[model samples]
Target: METFTEWRTWERARADLAARSLGPDDLVVLDRAVDAALRWHGDQRRPTGAPYAEHLFEALEVMVRGAGVTDLDTLVAVLLHDVVEDTDATVSDVEAEFGPDAAELVDWVTKPPAGGQGRQAKRVAKTAYLRRLREAPPDAIRVKLADRVSNVQTLDRMPPDFQRRYYLETVTYVMPLIELLGDDTGGWFSGWYTSWRRRFGHLG
Candidate 1:
């Protein structure tokens, strides 16, 4: 696998985005969205020890450039996909800045467990989150699918037990949600899901 600093994954994403012919407006909006997300998630890092912005950018690139999604709302949602989860950013802040659709999409995708939850409670909360994701807006689902696809591809970089848990969660929780997106997004998600299933289906 490529080292994190090599960033081969991001390089491929950049190539795809370049080929997508994103308009000047698209570029402007995406730049603003990235800047906002960075300000919100300043200096945060994921468990995998990578800058959180990398994951956000990957999700946005997958949806906007890889899935051929041109809708402004979906693109914005992709860029801000993890803000509510990883930062102090509020849904109202997103709404006031990016409008209702983008904020709603981000809110739908954010999964917050019930306060003071234990293991079973967290599991129940997760189940409920997935259920709500089913009823969420299509743009939210699109951002979610893109996020899951990126996560699955990087699963190997995590610890063995975490990988197992994440794999099972992807199959059980995320795969169904992927089916709820628009045609183009569902197709992109299916491609990633099929590859993940083929490579890791035998694991617990």
Candidate 2:
């Protein structure tokens, strides 16, 4: 079944890890990351009306269950990835709390500022960001690949025109990163993109 849901609570995250045979050390990092994400993103909601934390949880699920990632820093980075973009949180703040590795991964996935530009300029900024991903560390690329997977899972809720533009952007910008993201994880993201195109082709 598709993993997209309205929200994922801490209990659900615990259950997901337990099912995957991740150990206590994994649990500790994930718990701390989740707590921090909630503390920072309290009351924020995605455009789809889901609590913002669900996006982070789903991205972690993609990394762990879908990509078989057990790395603590990678998982923690997924949880805090959007904090810098959506909140007042900074890369230094994340580094101070979770360490340099997580902060770096978050930075790789974080989109640079568009300077309050219009849609076209924002697209240009995103294109530039995707190009930079080609040079990012492998784990950082994986985090972004997983992030795209989570984001696309809810794409159907978007307006038709927006869906068309987003699908095109994914193909043009994100598809090339598959090689940088490595085989298993990259393959999953490719499959999601392909299937999403077929499912939403009319919008495109």
lDDT digits (tens) for residues 77-98 of candidate 2: 9899898988888999999989
> After superposition, which runs of candidate 2 have C-alpha atoms over 4 Å from their true positions?
1-7, 115-117
- Give me the candidate number with maximum TM-score: 2
Compared with the true structure, the alpha-carbon lDDT of candidate 1 equals: 0.76
Clashes of each: 0, 0
How accurate locally is residue 45 in candidate 1, as Cα lDDT from 0 to 100?
85
Model 1 lDDT tens row, 48-98: 788887887767666665677878888888888788877889999899889
Which portions of model 1 miss their true places by more than 4 Å? 1-19
Q: Please give the CA lDDT of all the candidate structures.
A: 0.76, 0.81
